[model samples]
Target chain A: MIVAKRKPFDEIMEMLEEYKKVLVVGCGTCVAVCLVGGEKEANILATELEMARKLADNPIEVDSVTLERQCDREYLAELDDKQTDYDALISMACGVGIQFLAERFPDKPVFPAVDTAGLAVNQAVGWYEERCRSCQQCVLAWTGGICPVTMCAKGLYNGPCGGTNLGNCEIDPDQPCAWYLIHERLAKQGRLHHIKQIYEAVGWRDTMPRTLIQPGYKKPEKEEAK
Target chain B: MSTDNGLKSGSNLEKILKAGHFAFTGELGPPRGTGAKEVIEKAQHLKGNVDSVNITDNQTAVVRMASWAASLLLVQEGLEPNFQMVCRDRNRLAMQADILGVYTHGVKNMLCLSGDHAKFGDHPDAKGVFDIDSMQLIAMVKQMRDEGKFLGGAEIEHPPKIFIGAASNPFAVPHEWRVHRLAKKIEAGVDFIQTQCIYNMERFRQFIKEANDMGLTEKCFILAGVTPMKSVGMAKYMKNKVPGMDVPDEIIERLQGAGKGKVAEEGIKIACEQIEEFKEMKGVAGVHLMAIEWEHKVPEIAERAGVLPRPTVE
Candidate 1:
């Protein structure tokens, strides 16, 4: 799932600079699962903002709302006319959702409260690790399920650099070398020869930012009179 | 020396290799700060003694003076510099731009390495941009030079003219596959191969033998890397700590036998012995002395190895 971290408190306050009435928006999807921008966290942020404003003697009023999934326009209709009560809105979702809110409320100032890290998996209750860079091209089949593009320090599709010591990466002793794992997995399968398979220089053209269209979906502009 | 004779001159390092000279190249770790004083001074000790000095790009992922700039600085001192480029930092566009930039500055030799990760360095939070790995990097640079076009097929006037190099670590995992990997790098247009630091003499000898059997030596100049252990602690650290580096126990034993204060001298003696072995090792073209943070000792090491009186291309 997409993982995001809260923007530093100072930065969040800075984003609401000069705003008395603010809306703290949250997402019920990925950001919520990561515990950064869910409804509970949104209330905590709103309370904190209220306390900070009261302490500053500015006494700003705040409203909190969490959408089912902020990326889709339909879920956002839950706000209806109530969103205009605030001078600005701070999105607690990922970058995609922030852009969605901005586009939906073109006139309202929308600030991003979270920085979208990468696609990550939950490692522990409070810990998450990024696993995919979404490079669009996957080579896991050749690498024994290891993602060299995301794991290797140099993202070397070939193998570990001369720097790998033991099983850990030369860069970080705590991190296991991605190539080492690939070698181990391939060796266990008696497919050591697979490790020798050299991948040519990756043609990056296919991995460039691209859009996927749903099949058989006829756009209104392309649809005939029917 | 029948092995030595007049040969074609390309880059200074290439000229030395072509002359059948036992070439020695030193590593110049760029300084973290802007002042080039320390780097230039360190390089001064290497000027007359080594064939070509290598300037590292942010070795260990620590920010340092740009390797290209350092290489240019060494050029000003009448010394040849092998500018090293790492893949962990830039994309193809920046890489191609820097290639042209380095060539314009008269830096000739290039060492293409997949740089260490940023997580190891001071800035663990910095984003890594490994747009291309070392092999692809080698092919791309070759593309620029031979085809006069970018990796993306865009034509550029006046391609970078320089010798290309890549690294090999026989001690890396799947150690048996290292030599075959060298073959792949050669196929990618590498002109020279600098293997990881040598300590496991037996393994390196085997690696060289296999490389020879594969006829890799004829395809590219292979320089075996040797780092002089500064102390018993260093020997132990590299042997046990550094990844892919195997400092045999016997060498550490020799260092320990050096008693207390003489370990440094013993390390140099060991390095000299390695150079002597490299001179006779089949398929080994030269010795790349990696006196990391110990550039001052390069001259003495080269002199002790009897590779002094560096061949003059002119």
Candidate 2:
């Protein structure tokens, strides 16, 4: 799931300083699962913003609403009935949802309240770790299901570099070396031959802004203009 | 030295090793800022004392003058540079472009490495571009040179003539697999190999013996890396702080035994001893003396190690 963290309170306050009234928006999907931008978080942020502004002698009005999923237009249509008196909209969703909300309400200024981290797995209630970079090309079959692109600090494509020490990364002793893990897993599975093959250089499909059209979703060319 | 048809790039280091001489090489790290004076001064120490000097590309991930540019500076100063290229900074296109560029400027040798992660360097926030690992980089260079083709299989009108080298770390984890890794590097078309700094002679000896058993030594020249520990503090730091560095407790104890005033001298003596031993070790072709930041001491170290008056080959 996509993971995000709330932006620093000071930065969020600074962005909303000019607005007299604001609406704090949240998503109910990935961000909610990660305990970052759920309805509870949005209400807490709204209360904190009201109290902080009242104390600064600049009292302002703030409201918050949590939608099912901000990325879908159908869920976003539920906001049409809400009063549109807000000077700015504060998005508490991931980057994609924030952009979608901005596009839906093009007139109101939209400020991001959370920084989208990456595609990750929830390790615990409050802890999460990145699992994939969505590099557009995956080599998991050869690497024993370990993603070197995300786990290794250098994102090495071949074997481990000289920095692998005692199965840990040179960057930090706590972080396990991705290649070392791959080697051990492959060795146990009797698939060591997979790593021996020289994997070619990554083509970097993610280098540009990527747009994927699924097989059935791509528009057909207009019948060749009969 | 008999002239053989097997000389790949005809680099000075390659020629010396191919001539059956116990070759000696040194390292010169480019400065963080743009200044040729430092590079020149450093090269002066290694001018006639070693076969060729390795110009590091942002060693430890710190920003520095490009290695190719520094290599050109060495070429201008009448010295051969083992131009180091790290996968941390460049994609294949940039790497191939620089290889061609450096060759035109008279640089001959190239060292492929997966550079230290950028998080450990000055620019911790910089994006690391490991589009290819060191193994892939070595294979790509071999393709460019031997096959006369780019990585994309396009014909190169004139490819860079490079003596390829890669780094080995026998002290890294899964010690049993180190020799296999060396064999893989040999298969990838590496002409020579320089290992990480060796303070744990026991493990390194075992690694060399395994390589010998696997017949990997016959395929490529193995240059053992040595760095003189400046002080006991540095020894402890390397043993504790630096990952993949196997500074055995015995070496640190030896450094401490040399009273505080004589630790540096003891460090030099230890390095010289390692070099002397490498000369007699089977399958060991050379010694890569890396006096980190203490380039001025290289000449003395090389002379004391009895590798002075480096050989010249046509």
Candidate 3:
């Protein structure tokens, strides 16, 4: 659930203008869920590119394909056979998928059509709001399910700030203060008293992140020795 | 005093609306199978009978023939194609980009909707991305037109004059909420509304009356949607499986009573009856024939309903 806002049309057109035959690829994963990267979107983009190009007398040829999961090696194999058809590729996947495609097809130029934002939860149907920062730690058990990282404009760890006005954030009058929501949530759970307990300062460092890392298996002695 | 006269000429949508009454419009669902030839053939069949043929992005959320390819084919064949743009699959950037692209290709009409979920269709594993609803997309388009700049502040030499159309499901779950949703679209400045498939004429007339009473009927052009139920199975599916659709028991029972060979004919007859009735109803601007898989029968349905007159030229 990556919360991403779409890029403007003119920017995309300028990118496509540089390529004559463009292969628009869509990823069927987080980007697809956010509606930025999907087969349908890729095709729509391809169509728009074709239309825009035709008007400019360039008449670009667009061939679109949607991979099941652009980040996976097996799913990315689908693009290997069709790589020769286009001069460049416009991927509708997230940063990861675009990188994977670039890694797989180093010979051809690959571009991203969507800018991947942070993880989001659907506030309602068709509305996605940023929720989590994936801080590599689970503190929700202590925070009572309210995320201060996303809710707070400053991502503050403790207490109200000068921006907190009458229980509402000064940044947005309509939004409830994150601290207020946290207080309410903790109060409902009868854990409001725990709010006073000083927790260790959080360190924001992610040296490496793996989406599908396996654990508990030791490699062969020869492989491990290397 | 002269500076106060900032009012301009009617928008492109106004030009299209003033172009004629009983303006015929039909939808083209991208094929699920490997047969775009069938889609092209059907578009050719609907060419003269309808004012514009709508190419759906992905109806029911199943992967299929691309709307842009199908629409490009239609335009190549010299037919006015209305491209159905959905926010279910793209964010605002992609949506705006695609709209501008289609406009450059001579696509005139656009029916915006928050498309169906993947769970409802064949691909259960598919992810549904609803970046923006129909209204937001409409506002984006209006912004592109009036301001001559995109949300990203990119300048445009000339913006497209696309007729902005939105969807309405008066028969949606919890009927009372439908009016509120329709009001949302109206407030968003949608030029026209094409409702979800209507089966009960009584229910449709009531919807029209209420809309007029709310002063919405006059603000936007209302096009009643009609889909011919193929058989008893389809009738049942439309009643139960189909989202945002209402199929009366009488129509279902009629289809159930009819045998295999006559079921399609009966369904077409009922749909035609609905259209004929819609033609006489006041405040009803036009009809959007969503023939679904049975798109070839659109000309027949239009002719049967007496809406066919070669779609009088403007």
Q: Number of the top candidate by DockQ?
A: 2
- For candidate 2 chain A, which ten residues in a row score worst on lDDT? A217-226
Q: Which 10 consecutive residues of model 2 chain B have the lowest summed lDDT? A: B1-10
Error of 3 at B82 (Å): 1.2
What is each predicted model's overall lDDT from 0 to 1? 0.85, 0.91, 0.73
Off by over 4 Å in 2: A81-83, A219-226, B1-6
Which candidate leads the pack in lDDT?
2
lDDT of 2 by residue, B179-240 (tens): 87888888888999999999999999999999999899999999999999999999999898
Report the CA-based lDDT of candidate 2 relative to the real structure.
Answer: 0.91
C-alpha positional error of residue A223 in candidate 1 after TM-score superposition, expressed in Å = 15
Candidate 2, residues A1-226: lDDT per residue as tens digits? 9999999999999999988899999899999999989999999999999999999888879999999999988888787667387889998999999998988888879999999999998788889999999998889999999999999999888878988978999888899999999999998999988987777777788878877788877755867311
What's the lDDT for residue A1 in model 1? 96
lDDT of 2 at B245: 94
Q: For model 3, how does the per-residue alpha-carbon lDDT over A48-80 read when each residue is reduced to its tens digit?
A: 889988989989999899989887878988878
How does model 1 score by TM-score?
Answer: 0.86
| Superposed Cα deviation of residue A5, candidate 2 (Å) | 0.4
lDDT of 3 at B6: 31
**Model 1: per-residue lDDT, tens digit, A31-149?**
99999999999999999999998887878888899999999878887776978899999999999999988888889999999999989999987789988877777988888888987
B37-109: candidate 1 lDDT, tens digit per residue:
8878998899889888889998888998999899889989888999999987888889989999988889878
lDDT of 2 at B31: 90
